[model samples]
Structures are given as structure tokens and as C-alpha cells.
Target: MHGEPADEGQYTVVAKNPVDKVQASAKVSVCTKSKVDKLADVAVNIGENARIQCQYSGIPISTIIWYKDGKLIPTNDQRFVITQETPTLSVLTINNTDMDDKGVYSVKLTNTTGDVEGKVNLTVKPIKPAITRDLDTSYTGTKGEDLILSIAGTDNPYPTCQWVKNNTELTPTTDPRIQFKENKKTNEYFLIIKNATQNHMEEYQAQLINVSGLIKSKKNKITIQKQPTFIKKLQTIRVNQTDTGKMECQIDALPQTRVYF
Candidate 1:
């Protein structure tokens, strides 16, 4: 028998002997393997529940299994809820969905005859950017020295970072001494100033922007000072008794320091 629904039925056989006649009858049952009919992709925002449905058709389904990213999902996981609303329909619900839950999900149905599988993709909606580690309130550097300011943040879609100084945007093209960089592994952004000078002293900020939203870090002040150096040594002058004496020296320093004798 082909084991199809139409092929199931009852059959009878009769045999006649020299003086007696006997008849026997038997009923046959058909079993069919499950087949996936529909599995639609799903999308949800973070902190929301993600539900995926799988529909199939079969005669006697023995078991159902779910997998994420080709790895079998453990039943002991409390975040996942699996329910069979009907013999042919199954649902998988993920509570408090996060970025980690976004991936390809698959469902497999098995029976004595055979098994069938279906897959669907899950996506987590992007959220507004947030600052995890902010820059220091102030940074001090010396003339001819290099300065770096960094900030770390988290976001669904990686955001672009812009450095602003005294309300003006800073870019490498405009100022060769300035450079912007990012560490994708740590989600940290950096603004570097090569050969820092007094001109680089100002209030700076970092702007993080993405499709979801934009965020700005706290303003950080950069202070640059030049080391003091003596341009000329003090000279001693000798005079006769009751005469006035003079001594002088020259020095260069930032902020103009006063000399005392």
C-alpha cells in the first residue's frame, strides 16, 4: 500500500474447502510524515516578546524541536516558551527579547514515517544610542604632546562619532592634527590630537548619531601649557659703598610667570 489517506481501508478474503468455508477480514491504518506549510519571519523590539509560528500537516506527529542559528534550543531555558496550539500548529515565544535573540530560528517535526523542517529569521529593532563610559571632565596636556579623548557607548546599529570643539565640528580634513577612530570590539570612540598646542585648548564633546537617535557626551575641557625655560641667566653687578646694585634675568613660560629676586 502507498500508505496514503485514500489507500486506508478494510479487506476481506474467503476460502472454500471440501466441506467448510472460512472468511477473514483486516483493517489497515495509514501514517504520513509531516510537511511544513508556512513559516513567516518575525521582528520585535527589545524588551518585547517575539513570537514565531509554524504550521504543518501530518497524520501522527511524534515530536517537535526548535533550533536557533542551527543549534538546538534547550528546553530548560526559561526565556523560551513552546506551545502546540493544535496538532498541526506550533508556536515559539521568546520573552524579553534582546539583540542576542536575533537570528535564524528553525522548527522540526518528526513522526514514525519521517521528519520535516522549516526556518524563519528574527530581527530586533534598533534603539536609541546610549553612553556607557563618558569622557573625563578635563584633560591636561603639554605643548608638542599628543592628546586622546575617548568615550564608550552601546547601540543596536553602530553609530557614527563626531568630535566638536567650542561648538565647531572637528575633522581630519579640516585639521590634519586631528583624527577620529573607533574600537568596534569595545564600542569605544576616540578623538586624537597630534602635537597638541595652546590652540587645541577648549571645551570638546563627542556626538553619537544613528538612525534611531542621537546622543552627546558631557563636555570635556582640554588645557595646554608650555614648560617654562630661562632665556638668560641673572647677572650680578658690583657697586661702591652706599651705591645701588642691579640684577636682571629673562625667562619664557606660558601664562607669563613673575620672577622674584
Candidate 2:
């Protein structure tokens, strides 16, 4: 008698006695089973609003319940809202969806006859693409030697990278001695200076550009080493034999080079 139209009708019961018969009659009303509409899955970014809805049909609806991950959800929470569009439609709204909001959501409808339940999945996407750190650049280049200035950066979404020296962007040059290379695996950029000289010594920095905009890394103070040079030649002094004397010279050098007398 679950859902048979024929089962819906009038029924009568009669008791027969020796001389007279009495009968009782009543009408049977078949209550329709509660039917719940399926809910669709939702995918949204963090800090965005999300809505899940379902519809039910029955003779009389007792209550509508909403649950998240098998736990009953109360409307007291400010972030959650339960609303009824019509007698048969119910909606659950989540304000400012976050990572914690990602889960299975279910809605149930109960009536005097029966109850029905439906579920939907929610996915909240995370935000990324911001630069985290730019390691400090510090390198000492020996004069007339191949030198490298490496800049390391970290970011969620990969970005366009470049090197800047003396407030100017570095690019491919006709000079084969000078080269620029990028290490995609490590997210690092390298600037190689061949035959490094005083000219190549300058404040070097790394720059990153992406949809978020341009971001610059810490400056790298580059220093080039040079051989020592005498500012004034040693002075000659005529000394008697076996007399103790000292020879003095005025010199200038980078990195404080050791001087031999």
C-alpha cells in the first residue's frame, strides 16, 4: 500500500447480529511521501558568498534541517542562514566562504508521511600569488674573473623575473662576456659578469612582475676586488753599514691586500 492509487478509497466494517446489523464507515486519505529535490555542488573562492538550495513536496511539511559534514547546523551562526523561498523550496546561504566551509552539505525534509534527504559538496579555493621573501644579494667578484650575482625569490604563482643594476633593467647584450640566465626549477635569476671590473660593481636587485603587479627584492651590494697599487714609490735612504733602517711606501688597495717589502 506504499503508492497504489487503488489503495486510496473508503472502507466500511459491519457486524451482523441475529435481527439487526450495524456498520461504521470512514474515508482513507493517502498522504503523499515527502520528495526532496537534489542539490547541486558548489565551488567558490575564499571570501565569496555561496548558496545551496533544495525543494520538497508533500501534503504537510514538519521541518527542514541542514547539516554540514553530518553535523546539524544551527542558524544562530552569523555566517550561516536558512531561508524558505516557498513552501517547498529551502535555501542555505554561507557568507564569506572560507577553507573551513569546504565540506559535504545535506538538507532533509520531514513530514507526517515520510522524510527525504539530499546532499551537495562544496569546495573553497585558496588565495595565492603573493611574494613571500627576496633573499639579500651579497657577492664579492675578483677582478678579471667570471662573476655571478644570483637572486632568489619565492611566490605562489610563478612570475616574470629580471635583474636591475644601477636603477636600470638588465637585458641581453651583444657582449658575449655578459650573460643572464634564469633557473626555473629554483625560481632564481642569475646575472653573470665576465671580466668583472669596477664598472660592473653596482647595487644589484631582483624584480618580479605578475598579475598582482611588480615587486622588487632586497638590493645586493656587489664589491669587486682589485690588486694593490702604490700611491707613492718607496723612498731611498743612504745608511751606514750595519745600521738599522726602515723603508716606507704609501700604497692603496682594495680588500686590504698583503704588501711585501
Highest-scoring model, lDDT: 1
Q: For residue 165, what is the lDDT in candidate 1?
A: 91
lDDT of 2 by residue, 120-163 (tens): 99988755434455645677878778987666655434567777
User: What lDDT, from 0 to 1, does candidate 1 have?
Assistant: 0.87
Regions more than 4 Å wrong, model 1: 1-20, 30-41, 44-55, 60-121, 231-251, 258-261
lDDT of each residue in 1-261, candidate 1, tens digit only: 356788788989999999999999998778887888889999997778999998888776647899999998768889999999998788999998878899999988898888888899999887888999998999998878899999999856778998999979998887899988899999999999999888888999999998789999999999887778888888767889998887778886665787776
C-alpha positional error of residue 22 in candidate 2 after TM-score superposition, expressed in Å: 14
TM-score of 1: 0.59
**Clash number for model 2?**
0
**Which consecutive 10 residues in model 2 have the weakest lDDT in total?**
126-135
Q: Residue 159 in model 1: shift from native, Å? A: 3.2
